[model samples]
Target: DGQKVTVIATDYTCIGEPVEINVIVSDLPNAFTPGSDGFNDIFGAGAELTIFNRWGQVIYEGTEGWDGKYKGKKVSPGTYYYILSVFDANNTKTTMKGSVTVVSDEK
Candidate 1:
């Protein structure tokens, strides 16, 4: 003789939810030298760089790249402050502020 069997099934669904985003700033270099020997010739203002003077005047702004020059001229040797802001690929925004020193061999 042979036997028979029966089966039952169920259905279900999942829902998605929104989440809050946070921003962070990292990988800040301690120091840099802007010599003209072709190595380390340019000064970096950090990621999403935005440099400003003591008076809060904007000196430079760019995307993690700087040639150590402003207005087609080399900047003097000294310390400068910079503010960095960025939005990651996930559309999250972050801001950071820090200081940097610019040195020259002629000094």
Candidate 2:
């Protein structure tokens, strides 16, 4: 999640223009494993997440969480992109984009 802040400048003469700023307040993981061992088995955030493949194809879209599967099959281990749409308390939507690697099970 993130927040929007407005800063105004005043120097005893008059108020200056307000500068709007978008502040990021969440840290997402760079990798995860859906090996069904109950440890990092799902990837999720406090917002609507849309996952995409390297070719810009959507693999998953929802808030429930991704189990590293597409169409009932496990995805190949690699880096995938994501777009997170977070709405702040002020109803301002912020989009955060990044990549998360899917680690294959060693066993």
Candidate 3:
């Protein structure tokens, strides 16, 4: 039997591309405690967070995040509304709207 031997070489390159992730907030909490419990203590930073009262009044606004406080006082326990606008480098803006309750104690 006559046979011929052949060798094949393969080359590959891992071309990587920068990937942009989705909004960091996947599970938006409906409530949080501002105390130092190490839990949902602060709002998402870099987000234009505007919290409104039940009457649609801006109760709190901060870019560093809200600690569930208004005017250095812990807001009362009640249903509050919020709007979060996140701006990226490309000027792409994402918005999230929901309600959050401020609780004095963990429940």
Q: How much is the lDDT of residue 85 in candidate 3?
A: 84
Candidate 3 Cα deviation (angstroms), residue 60: 1.0
On TM-score, the leading prediction is: 2
Which residue pairs show backbone clashes in model 1? Answer: none
Candidates in descending lDDT order: 2, 3, 1
After best superposition, candidate 3 residue 32: deviation in angstroms?
A: 0.5
Which predicted model would earn the best lDDT? 2
**Sort order, TM-score high to low:** 2, 3, 1
Per-residue accuracy of model 1 over 23-106 as CA lDDT, tens digit each = 343655545566577766655544578877667777888985666667877777777787777666566667777887777756
Off by over 4 Å in 1: 1-25, 43-46
Backbone clashes counted, model 2: 0
Which lDDT values do the candidates have, in the order given? 0.64, 0.86, 0.75
* Model 2 steric clash pairs: none
lDDT of 2 at 59: 95
Could you give candidate 3's per-residue lDDT for residues 1-107 as a string of tens digits? 11233444444765455454433444677888788788878765567899988899887888988888888988888889999887655567878999888777656
